[model samples]
Target: MRRLFRLLTIYAVFARYRLDELLPDHAASGIVKFFIRLHPAAWTASTQVHPWGRLRLALEQLGPVFIKFGQLLSTRHDLLPEEAIGDLANLQDNVPPFGEQAAFDIIEAELKGTTEALFGHLERTPLASASVAQVHAGSLKDGREIVVKVIRPGIETLVQRDLALLLTGARWLQKIVPETKRFHPVQVVTDYRHILLGELDLGQEAANGAQFRRNFADSPVLYVPEVHWNLSTNKVLTMERVYGVPVSDTQSMLAAGVSLEHLSELGVEIFFTQVFRDNFFHADMHPGNVMVSLKDPQNPQYLSLDCAIVGSLSKQERFLLARQLMALLDKDYEQIAILMVEAGWVPQSTRIHEFQNALRTVLEPVLERPLNEIEFGPILIRLFQTARRFEMQALPQFMLLEKTLIHVEGLGRQLYPELDIWEIGRPLLEQWLRDQIGPGAIMQTIKRNGPALIEQIPHIPKLAWDALQEMRKLSENQQKLLQQVEQGHLKQLRRDRIITLLGLIGLGAGLSWGFNPHWSLSWSEIPLGAWVISALGASLILTRLRSNPDD
Candidate 1:
């Protein structure tokens, strides 16, 4: 019943927004339009707002899952129009906080204690509230300042319910509209489900924070706060409180003498280092989750928070990504197309020349712009879009990476409009590529695997001997099989020759009986014995000639 109500609410919102009008002109759209017209609200739906604005508003009204979907869609420049992307980018998780008593109750329930007993002092007011959780300022008994995050009451059930509806809609869309398969609506919803569920688990977020903190332990450009595991649970997380100017507050940063240029460049460097060197990145790098430390004004450092969604690449993906970046920097469209096909991003049968031309058409103009004017994130989106035309498969990891890049690049460009991401990223990628394939890399590979290789040396002779014995046995068996086949062939030949000779004799007897002068052409004039002999001879000759020697 609850699910049915939710579904109805979604439809109501859809009708209220006149979302059917947003559908492209296709057979599926006609079916959708027919149904939408049946809803009374669709006739009176407001048309004052633009379609994109209505879309954003409708998603916000549909609740957190849809809002999160809008947030994700905002980064998909390849899939959505610029206006829609802009509108969706404005979608925020600014949900009203649950009551303070409820928050305290959840903390107590998850931690197995009273809130008062657990903390030095827990604030009744929330420091911040988002779709999944709310934060409250507090401290430990030892007076160490901290912030407590409590999962919203019953958000898991709500998330699951909404995700189910989204998945259903995605499947229906795919089934009804064949062209929607390229958009991978089902996969998008499925990936979103995992991301949303992961965010609900504070323990996972805590572990992510710890790993990120460890990755940048000695770094001057980035800082990650320590997780207080003793007080952390799957539904409750406590971490050391951090205070700094929000990265988005350019006025405050500038007042503190922070060099926006240096800060923006550092952001790019940190992004590349995390992706190439650590192989782990903070996927959610929105401004609300980032801050700037004022202690070092000239050399700004980034304070990262909310490590719920992190991304990493496999070794091969990392290598290919690096090569692709290098190819992009060198304006080698053919190499870029080749690498994409080799990486299995596109089908093996994809025409390289056509793909190259498509890539050039999209990228050449963007690359021709000044370094400061180029944006890697949008370039990647365009590249993926071109690849999609050639039937590129969905890559979840790459999607996360692309989203992160969008966040990082957007943040950088906001800080300094003249930020040259190409200038900052080119050297990092070049160095990483060299490290992977240079002479030193070969030595390192040998050094890492030498012991394992040496351990298997003593059994080499035994393995080789066993392989040779197996091959010899196979050869002998094959020779015996060939001999049997040859013998069968010889027997068949002899039998066929005997049958041929018998057939010839029978045929000769039939001819002599039919041409004899004593017998007239009429059947009545021939003797019964002669007739029987002639028939028997003809039957024998026909049977012998028709027989198959092999059978």
Candidate 2:
């Protein structure tokens, strides 16, 4: 019954989006066509809005869960066509805001103080409203402007229930369609669960903000909002409010004397710095979340918001990813293959040559275009599809990192179409490589690993002795196993040889008795085939006794 309800809800969403028109009928995918035919009345063609428009509208009506799904799907340009992906990228939480009193109640409860006590000046109206939370502009007691973000009443409950429903449906789908297990749908759900839960805690978001701020601490190119530690809570966040025109407002930015070219370059710098230097990035980077600092026209600074969904890479992953990108840039498909396997995105059993051919198929066309013309989204999607053929597992870390980078790149393109992110980013990458591989990097590594190395010095001889003892045991076990196989084979050989010897003795005695005309039975009375069988048995036993174990 729950399955039916969820399926019906999905069908309704599909109908609302009028996706039936965009999809093929009998020619579409088997599952898609089946769904379409079953709900002919539920879906309609585009007589009103474009398919993309309708999709956005449909996702909007479906609310947060579906919106977030669409948002994630937007990053997967490889799966959805460009048009559909564009529409989905536009999806956001535009649902009506919860009441201001509700927001006030949250702030008061989470901060353990009244709104007045928390903010020197508070607004009855929210600065912005969204599905999960709403923001209100206020002032701190020190007369500094701040944005008080409060979670909507009952949202956590709603999100939790919806996530449970999604998990149940996903598991049901996996059971019904075993092939989808290849996609690791369960892991995707778990990944989404982490992001959603992290978003629920305002303190985590504050921490994310703090990390970003620290990463770009001395940078003149970006401004991460300062988290108000004193007044922040798990459900409420008070941040140093930033005032600037949205990066999307090209005219306003131009009017304010911000340089679009420099702004675009700075955007790339921020991305490389986050990924290569900091290993942390703001994952939810929509246009609204980005703003331009008006004070620096020639060298624009970015003001980023909503750090609930950030990305991080492990040290090993970062190393492999950098090498992978560098290999792709150099057109060395073999290195790309090696690095991907090293990253564990591909299995060790993956045929490198075949993987290279698949990669070259998608990558050659992409590299043909100039770096500025590269669409990171479609490239990722193509790479994902090619890797999928080789049974690649999308490491959640890399997938999210790639998504964030694409988001940053896409935002750059939106603001400045001719922006060459790679141009601005390559120097940074080179410098980062130098800092990592140069003498300084070696010194740091030694510094970090030295203490542990010294601690192991006194135990080295004893540890080596222990390891040698273990090696001896392992060798003994292998020898025993080999001997057991040899013994079993020899036993079979011995049994055959013994049976043959007995048969030979009997056959020789019978033959001699017959030739001498002293046999007990007449030739007519004896079985004629018995002597032939005895002779054959003797030959078989001789062969078994001479048989080799390898054979």
- Give the residue spans of candidate 1 off by over 4 A: 454-469, 480-551
**lDDT of candidate 1 over 198-244, digit per residue (tens):** 99999999999999999999889999988999799999999999889
Per-residue lDDT over 204-228 for candidate 2, one digit per residue giving the tens place of the 0 to 100 score: 9999999888888877988888998
Q: Residue 13 in candidate 2 has what lDDT?
A: 75
Quote the positional error of residue 423 for candidate 2 in Å: 2.0
Residue 444, model 2, lDDT: 98
Model 2 RMSD vs true structure: 4.3
Predicted structure with the largest TM-score when compared to the true one: 1
What lDDT does each candidate get? 0.88, 0.78
Please report the candidate that would top lDDT against the real structure. 1
- Cα deviation in Å at residue 94, candidate 1? 0.3
Candidate 1, residue 307: Cα displacement in angstroms equals: 0.9
TM-score of each: 0.88, 0.83
Pairs with backbone N, CA or C atoms under 3 Å apart (clashes), candidate 1 = none
**How well does model 2 score by local distance difference test?**
0.78
